[model samples]
Target: MGSLVASRPVYIPLSPCPRLPAPCSSWYSCSPYCLLQILVTFENLAAWGRCLCAVCPSPTTIVTSGASAVVCVWELGMAKGRPRGLHLKQALYGHTQAVTCLAASVTFSLLGTIVSCAGAHLSLWNVNGQSLASITTAWGPEGAITCCCVIEGPAWDTSHVIITGSQDGMVRVSVSWAE
Candidate 1:
């Protein structure tokens, strides 16, 4: 259930580990590809919360969400010629419950969407961090959603599809297009 994005900007879901000066953990050794972008601490995000889900949209950035009920955009920067770490580039808010799943639109090069699942609802955020829209996973109860994916829309069809699944064994597919 827990996995990192296999893309350029690898993302690791983590909770702040005390004792060590850094994000603390032995698992970091398994992932030698990513330079480890930890949110040691930030402005008002004292309760940064645990990272439940993440997706890398760009080579230098990753989108993460969890118990904080908000989406965070992190950018990797270099220091002294070494990969420094992540900088809080931006934050997207609106979901009331903890977001558990995230998916990036393939059309993101055109300012694509990032779909996040909180409870039984899905919230769409633009690559620019703007909250676009929110929708219920299904008309009938299907329990809390566990995962989601955004299928890119074809050239002939301007509508993309969002697929969501839950612990209750229900999968819902919905079509969405930019207006």
Candidate 2:
């Protein structure tokens, strides 16, 4: 990738921390190299459902963040401190655990297709913020799903596929059952 364009330290105060005085566990930048999307988790708190992970589907106008099964969508311009309207456009809830990763396909047409992984579960959501399909793995020594990506099908096909990696070192591929 090109040299870093700008580097700034953003400090989210501990006031939002469910447990006062505890430092945030981790944070990830959802913004793509070209586009700036701001979606970050403050801490690893399971109480009050604060921990989260996020990703941008395409480098377009929509920025999505996933936390505790709730997906928050924001406009691209909002990242620049613009207050034209409510930055948060939608909040989708379905996943049973803190979303560990998200992948939005470039083909987010009117269908609004996106994939998210949490714990051992993978979920597919539509543009209308509806859960199209989801798969949950059983409890085992194998670990939770930790990462995900979208795979566009052939040009002739409209449906997309999802690939996810688990803490157990296994990668799984899944297609939308609603399609």
Candidate 3:
């Protein structure tokens, strides 16, 4: 006769508290089980959100402020426990309405800068959370900024340009001197 064997089960708990504020619009993670970023959307407040924290390895993590809320990079791994508090590095506050989009520069290592787009404006910021520069849109008649990107040239000079897709279905591209 064959002997019977038993199997064991494992369990994991859901987040104890709401990880995001009201109206979380988007989120991204950098690695599996390691880092996380979240975007929250709100109304009539600051009109924009801020990146809360970057996990260890410094610049490998990037955060962006959007029209409705802030966005962060997320990773999947052993949860390191909820962040107690996040330090504010830089802030791009000029738009009267919500910031709609954000984008970071392609990082080569753990220490690099990120560029963000907010409602027809583009801002360059450092890893330590300092705003290098903020420029308004030059190419479009704007009410809200929907998206942005950082383009690098052959000479390593990055062109900080923003393509804002408006509610009116128009796309406008603007260049920033901050780049």
**Residue ranges of candidate 1 with Cα displaced over 4 Å:** 1-46, 78-82, 139-142, 154-158
Model 3: residue 13 alpha-carbon error in angstroms: 26
Candidate 2 on 4-108: residue-level lDDT in tens?
Answer: 133344554322334433343323322322223444322322332553665665443454444556777644433465322324556777876567788887766
Candidate 1 or 2, higher TM-score?
1
lDDT of 3 at 66: 44
TM-score of 3: 0.42
Q: In candidate 3, what are the lDDT values of residues 58-173, reduced to their tens digit?
A: 33243545444343333222235533223333454444544455555555232344555555566665555556776665445544455555543333554445455554466766
The residue pairs that clash in candidate 1, if any, are 108-112
Best by TM-score: 1
What's the TM-score of each model vs. the native?
A: 0.67, 0.62, 0.42
Better of 2 and 3 by TM-score: 2
Ranking by lDDT: 1, 2, 3
**Residue 41 displacement (Å), model 3:** 18
Native-to-model Cα distance after best TM-score fit, residue 151 in candidate 1, in Å: 1.3
Q: What's the ranking of the predictions by TM-score, best on top?
A: 1, 2, 3
lDDT of 1 by residue, 79-150 (tens): 665444577887888888899999987646654788998888899877788777898765444578989998
Error of 3 at 92 (Å): 5.4
Q: Candidate 2 vs. truth: CA RMSD? A: 12.3
Q: Candidate 1: worst 10 consecutive residues by lDDT? A: 1-10
